[model samples]
Target: MKFLLIGQGLAGTLMGFRLERAGHQVEYVDAPEQTAASAVAAGIINPITGRRFVKSWRIDELIPAARLLYTELEDFLGVSLWHPQPLIRTLYNRGDLNDWQARSADPGYSEYMEDEPATGRLPELTQPVFAYAGVRHAARVDVATMVAAFREKLIAEGRLTSGVFAYDQVPALLGADAGARNGNPAYDHIICCEGWRARFNPWFADLPHGGNKGEVLIVKTQAPLLNLMFKHRVFLVPLSDDTYWVGATSENQFSHEEPTAKNRTFLADRLAEVLTGTTYEIIDHRAAVRPTVKDRRMFLGTHPDWPQLHLFNGLGTKGASLAPCGSQWLADYLLAGKPLPEEVDIRRFNQPLR
Candidate 1:
């Protein structure tokens, strides 16, 4: 079957690859002005989350699937993108240390937690009054490179069109026989992966999209190169050379997508608390809106009224880990006859949306 994919962000890119691999043709249409959260994302996949240190939702399923998918894509793209790095979580206080020990004893955290706290791992870093713990099987993906390479490859293969997708033209363009093969290219279905911009999409505008603006910084630090991700409040992920991706300030309420001075100061103040011996220079700053849902779950499945229209978005901040499995599931449902898991299906919203 031939498919038309709107937006070449992480979700659409992954889904397009899956559909093509499954013996289907995919054509992509994306707007140049679209703010893709995937481009600026840190792509860090952490199993444990929050101050309470509870495991992420369905992390067991998400992490393993992510490992397999990224490893495969690494070989396919012939680029080094996926890096499995340990995460060193700093213990802020005695209470934090106690909670870590308690959770470590639980069998559920066996695969994710370290056997002991890494107290002396970084002597240079300010001696935490409490302690530090290591998380295993944590990793990062070079999302920006992956997205650019995929987009370029699609464009080269005559599968991508670069321009704004006028929604009004869609109905007239796809008239009569949905899959009819004519001189002009026609698609059997059009899947919307328009990220945060989906809130403006007439078809999916009603899906309760609560877009959050996130800001991150790329900095060159004099600190010694480390293979593990350092996290306290803000995460410092090592890239190549002496540069690291430092950031992510989550502002649920923001005026625009532009980087703000307030967030920059916030990140710098927090980063200073973690890096005692390291001198760093800010190299780049970026901001984008994450396609977060009000309920904090992914939005998936076809339009309620339009059978030929589908949506596969709302992976939010966890796009790297979520997209791998989510895209494959969407492809399977589209190509095969599998039913979408109830949790992610858009049908859960019973009220009419404006």
Candidate 2:
């Protein structure tokens, strides 16, 4: 089947990749000027989070699937995209350490949690903390590079159009009998992977899609910090050379998507507090709105009214680990008549979106 994908961000790119790999013809329409959150994301995949150190939802299944896909994409793209790095987070007090120990002892959590981690430069760079704990099976994905590479590939193959995709185009092309568009073959389905922007889609207007804006700063350190992903007050993820992806401030309430001076200062302050012994320069600051759902689950499935219209969104803050599996699930349901997990299916909403 042929598919028309809107937005070439992480979600759309991965979804398109999955479909094309399944022997379906896929095309993308994206506004290159729009700010995609995936472009600025740190792409840190942490298996454990929160003060209680609970495991991420469906992490065991999510990780293996993610590793398999990313590894496969690396071979297909001929680029190194996955970085297997451990994560070390500071423990603020005795209470935090005890919680970590308890979580680490659980059979389900043992493989992901480590009581002792190699500190490397953390001891020299950061202020004194109660302790530090390591997390295993963590990695950093170069989402920006991946998306950019895929965009180029799409352009080269004439599969992508670089322009804003107007929503009004949906209704005219919603069925198998729909006429060809712009002299191109009619698409079997029009999938919305537009991220935070999907809230504005008229067809899925009642799905309760939400957006959270995040700001991140890219800094170049005079000396190298720890190679592992580190979390102190905020996340400090290592990138290429002496640069690091430092950020981000999450704002559920925001008037605009531009990078603010307040958030930049806040992130810079935290970096200074953590990288105590080194000097660094803030090279860039960027912000984008992440597609969010009230229940913290991704949105997937066909529209209640128009069967040819579908949505694959709501990966939220964990897009790195979530997109691979989420896209695969969407593709499986689309291609093989498989059932979508109730938690993610759009039909979970009782009332049909008007």
Best by TM-score: 2
Q: Alpha carbon lDDT of residue 103, candidate 1?
A: 91
Which regions of candidate 2 are displaced past 4 Å? 175-185, 351-354
lDDT (Cα, tens digit) per residue for candidate 1, span 273-320: 777766789888899999998877898888776677899989888998
Report the error of model 2 at residue 95, Å. Answer: 0.8
Q: What TM-score do all the candidates reach, one by one?
A: 0.93, 0.95
Report the lDDT tens digits of candidate 2 across residue range 170-283.
Answer: 866553334333443367799999999998788789898999999999999887777899999799999987999997898999999899999999999888888887888999
> Candidate 1, residue 238: CA error in Å?
0.5
Flag clash pairs in model 2.
Answer: none
Kindly report which residue pairs in candidate 1 clash with one another: none
Cα error, candidate 1, residue 36 (Å): 1.4
lDDT of 2: 0.89
